[model samples]
Target: MADAATSPYLVLARKYRPRDFTTLVGQDAMVQTLGNAFKQNRIHHAFILTGVRGVGKTTTARILARAFNYEDASGPHPTLDLSVEGEHCRAIIEGRHVDVIEMDAASNTGINDIREIIDSVKYAPSSAPYKVYVIDEVHMLSTAAFNGLLKTLEEPPPYVKFIFATTEIRKVPVTILSRCMRFDLRRITPEIMTAYLQSILDQEAIAFEPEALAMIVRAGEGSARDNLSLLDQAIAHGNGMVSAETVRAMLGLGDRARIIDLFEQLMGGAIGEALDTMRQLYDLGADPQTLVADLCEFTHLVTRMKIVPAAADDVSLTPDERSRGAALAGRLSMRALTRAWQILFKGHEEVARAANGLQAAEMALIRLAYAADLPSPDDLIAKLANQPAPASGPPPAAPLARPSGGGGASALRLEPAPVFAADPAPAPPRAPAPPLAPAPPAARARVG
Candidate 1:
């Protein structure tokens, strides 16, 4: 009990770390290829894993390291069928294997550090068949360090296997990249992540709402490690039972239903209602920038549903989102949805930089609402072209009347102007009329 009290608890991310390729989620293609390579004994000397942080670049590299040198109790030969525990698995997993070396290129970015690797590559493994080198954040290596590794990386010893992991693959030199077998890990989809989180919670005997799990998945943004970390915090914050409200407050997320409602109001041109909703959300501790981002995401989802009807049935969307989004997709045109997207996207940026976030968000919503009501240029043009033309021919002339004053007086009558017909025909040629004399002074004065 005293030992347990002194030892710190492991976080979920580390405690449930994937032990083998079979346990890796959302990376089936890479796993399949590697599995085939191991079966065929066509393993590459140098391998590079690249992806966003928390997406398992480092984890995959470590798994590869263990697999490269794994030896089952039944046989000493290297094998990929590591379903059973291997002789070197524990040591490699604990980062204490003599044959498997894990290096942080972030701290060892100098040519001297890489020179050590180049010097050591000539030596064979002491225990395992292959000596594995795992370099994390390989892009952080300096130019000189990269240059030092280029020749060896391109042609390494038969007993050596180099594994590189990086979040920024672009920063890695082409020379180094050309020598390695690159595997790009993709972000885990929200559906898969949500299910994974639920499984973990169930295993821990912790109660959780599905909506709460969904919120955690969203907060993770497709990173499994990040999601697990958030889940750990949520479990603690919720006191063993995760609820939607607790998760929302923990992540500072706005209400998903209300955000959808706000979007609907904007699309319906309900500016007042949208503003009120935004205020209500803000008052409830939702960030203005986050709300705008949510609206943008909602707009994108609707656009997707519009283009691909199958997207309306995606499991990633909540029940409310699927129903509301389908209705919106059917109600709004591509042009209107696209315009709304642009407005919200730009407005998100404004809110991010505004002195008063709520004000900026409200202004953006107003812009979206007004823009929704306004017709596109093409629609406006079509409407104007379709309008009916006025009646053709001159208006009837007024009756001519004399003024009370009689000296050289002439009466003048005003006539309505002729209206043009839609696609009017040319009139026949007519004889010219004689010029009229100037009006008399008395008539002019009387008319005035």
Candidate 2:
């Protein structure tokens, strides 16, 4: 179906596209490098910016274009005014400037197109001092087009500048690349992506739980554009408040709440309950790989809690998730949690790549359930050392805690568990008082 109102909402992606060098995310190395070069007036005549899809390659090009074409009343050009915003900057953004031209080489791949560009370069800009030719997907230009433009590219008019951008730098010939200064834009990091998304959500007056924002960040992979696209849908899909539940449904993720329950059952060695939870999720149309992935994140949160208990207060968790996580942490040991994480991660890979992902997932869950009951290598060794040789009738319900020569375990105990009715570690029985004959006799005499 077509969109309800095409023009009503400008997505967080396009709406918040970086307007200047400072706004670019997770490209600090490139931004600082370019900023320093511009300050030193060491910029080259031709340049290339390379990166993956939606990683701000074109945006960077636009920023460079404005920087090069920019001129102040003092007549220094972008060399003096590097800011990519203003009245003239708006024109540059809208692609209306006489000097700044943006070409999509994908559609205009031919010799004549190159010739037309070549012809225009001989004459300097009619208005702006530098004529910037931004060819997007420059790798798409035909052999003839590249050949035709080679001479001008090697040595264009003093005022003509070329800025090429490509998703695949390997496609462009070495001869073409050697003439330009190249900067490879990098994919944004999850932390940077999360912070940026939070800012956008805040400005929109949208209420989003931190975990929901992290989901969007992870979903983006590395592209600010992709994250914004997801954010757009998330904003529209929710009641203007993005929450974990909304993000999960939007991304086709398993319900985290249910996933957590399944995880708890796995930790507690309840295989039947874990499988039942999986079926319930499956009935709700949850993908197995997604469910595993959500579990991966849940494991990560628990691991974080292990490392820095205070991190439980981190914004990435919804309030309820934080509370639940605290409870889960309190109940489980770090070693067991880490082991579960490893098994689930491996299972996710197997399930994701399998022909029958659901079956793979079910099998994976069973494997995890088995892993939950098995002892770690360390524990296995300890048990073997202390095993009651060949027990006959119904082995003890649970193993006893180890102590040094009957002394209670203490050094390794970070925090003691709370007291309960059937607590396994009973308080050491109090020793009987020494025969109280002397003290008792004195007390009896005083009573008499």
Candidate 3:
């Protein structure tokens, strides 16, 4: 056996692939279920593993295969505690075990390819306790191939086990899906990915900055394999030291502080300054689409901070992001932040599709800046409701005639009618007017 020090270099992704259930991250539910099933001897003959790319669907399938054929001096029994490699573990993991067969449906998607599997099910295990078949990207199989697989897949020999992996679970027919015990592998969350990457760096004795790890986590987007691959590149790029500046340059990411500043300039309606900042970032190797996405992300962060102040305490955030984001959240209204998000969100797609991404990004920033100055619908409604109604001239004075039998004419002044605003205020309580004097009988008769 070759020692790691003397062997050719292995990529971090391959070097650190999880060898057993215990090492797998962000899949505790599936791991527990499998453990319970194996303990009870209730393991199914056919198991389907489904998840997005890089989330470990194929890796899970391989692990399942290893579990099925696990053997030791105690006895030949299935188990999930693969902490120690069993009799055939090394061969199986190396994909050289005669009893453990691996197939890629992507390259071989036809009835003939599946026919071989159907024919092989009748045979017994060559050495291991169980004959395990691992098929990857199973959704790529042709319709006829799937139909051919249906009968054999439903009822394989007691000594045989089938494990299928697919990225597109929907593409796999319901008939195929219904016949198997399905385990949906979840994407590794950022928190878990961050820890996992740090652990790997520690084992490799590589130095890494926390902010650099955060960038890698963001880029990974919950994919373990992707995160590891990125970590490898960052380690190489930084000459064994992963720094935030190096990761930013490697990923074409803008500085977090500068990104926050850009957000401020846009929200402050400083279009010229924002545009200048964006161009400078682009010249520094930042991607326009990535920059727009950063704006959208910051908008989301500020919005979250506004609604949930506790979000500002997240460890993934840089000190600048936390302080400035919290301040912006306090200063900016929810409506402004939401509107900025919308503009930037739409503009991200435009930048991706545009012939010139920088120009498209500039236009998006301009639109966002101009839109920030426009009052929200609610603001407009409040303003309209608060305005004073139009003033009218003073009410005309009219004569109040005296009774025919009495003295001279009296003048009565009428106040103008009350002017109501768009949203009128509640009327004030009124005191009863004094009773008017009644006209004399002769005055009433003459007026009539």
Candidate 4:
């Protein structure tokens, strides 16, 4: 046995990888279904596991392979309770088990590559109860390869069990998907992820501030592997004691309180203050794109709080976010929040492409600040509707007095003057008299 000091140091991600269903976090639903299936002896011959990266797709595939081949003193039976290492558990987990074959579809995507699997499916397990083939990134397989495996995959021998894992489930054909039991792994929520990380830190005897941990969790964005990897780097950077300042510095993140202040300034139409805050953050090593992304996230949070008041109580949110966010939500209209989100979201991309990220970020902030005072379309429409209508035309002409009639007493009554259409046509031109008319008149007078 190697000395403790001489043993190679493993990163937290691999060191804390879930070994069994009991240890897996944020996948209770899938685990429950599999457990029920195993309990009822209704195991499917093949299964396709799909999810985003770091959600344990490949891990679940391996776990399934182990369960299929699991055996102990009792007998050969597929089970989910992997508490006690079975006869072949160590070898399978170590990935050297002959009967449990693992293949990367990314590297071997050709039809010929799949032909090997087709040819080998007939062979029985050497030591384990079943021949388990685990193909990862199965969506990368060629169309011909998938077609070739269809018939066999649909109806494989009793001794053969197949497990496929892919991040892109849509890329897999419907025919292939129809033939296999599919399990969609979910992203780990922040609450569960936090508990899992805390447990690991406790076991490893590392100290971490809750705020620091929350920052890490936010950075992870609901991915277990990503969180673990970030945790590992954080530990090293913090010198075994994770602090919020160190993590913020490591991630190039602005101060949360300052970010909140900046958001408030932008939404309050204080462009100068917001730009100053932005410059300070930039000088402190905060990436402009990241800063804008953080603002966008805050905008989304405020929007959620406005829509669903319960969102403010989420475990992932800090005290500052809970209180300040609720206040912001109460004061700001949903339209304004949505508009801020749009501007910040677009600004993030602009910052990414700009020659000077800080300048781009400032420009985006200025736009948001100016837009803060602008009324939403709905509000503008409402304002227009509420205003009194303008005078349709010039006020009716002054009342006119009618001339007194033949009655003994004359009376005047108010009446509106007549109105005419604009631009009346001109009268037709008169014709000229002929000169011969004058000569006829003179002849009549002299000789008639």
Q: What is the C-alpha lDDT of each candidate?
A: 0.88, 0.82, 0.90, 0.90
Give the TM-score (vs. native) of candidate 4: 0.86
Please, what are the lDDT tens digits per residue for candidate 3 over residues 301-388?
A: 9999999999987767888998999999999998888889889999999999999999999999999999999988998999999998
| Model 4 alpha-carbon miss at residue 179, Å | 0.8
Q: Candidate 3: TM-score?
A: 0.84
Task: Report the backbone clash tally of model 2.
Answer: 2
Whose lDDT is higher: candidate 1's or candidate 4's?
A: 4
Give lDDT tens digits, candidate 2, residues 1-448.
Answer: 3575565766677779877777878888987777788888887889998998899988888888788877666564554234535445777776688888899999999998988898888787887768899999999999999888888889888888899999989999888999989989888877678888888888888888878887787678788899999988998899688987888888888766787888888887898998899988988878889888888888888878877889776554566568888888877778888888888899999997899888888888888888888877898799899976886544334444666676655444334444467758888999998884555877879989
lDDT of 1 by residue, 1-448 (tens): 9998999999999988998887889999999999899888899999999998898888888888878877775666655666887888898888898988889999999999999999999999998878999999999999999999988988889999999999999999999998999999999998788788888888899988888887788778899999999999998998888998998888877888998989888888999998899889888998889889888888998899889989876555778888988888998899998888899899998998999988898999999999889978998899999998866755468667777776553777576666666987889999899899999999999999
Rank all candidate structures by their TM-score, best first, as comma-separated numbers: 4, 1, 3, 2
Assess the local accuracy of residue 20 in candidate 2 as a C-alpha lDDT between 0 and 100. Answer: 78
TM-score between model 2 and native? 0.69
What is candidate 2's CA lDDT for residue 411? 41
Please tell me which predicted candidate would have the highest TM-score against the true structure: 4
lDDT: worst 10-residue window of model 4: 404-413
Task: Point out the higher-scoring one by TM-score: 3 or 4.
Answer: 4
Candidate 1, residue 1: Cα displacement in angstroms equals 5.6
> Judged by TM-score relative to the true structure, which candidate is superior, 1 or 4?
4
- Per-candidate clashes come to 0, 2, 0, 0
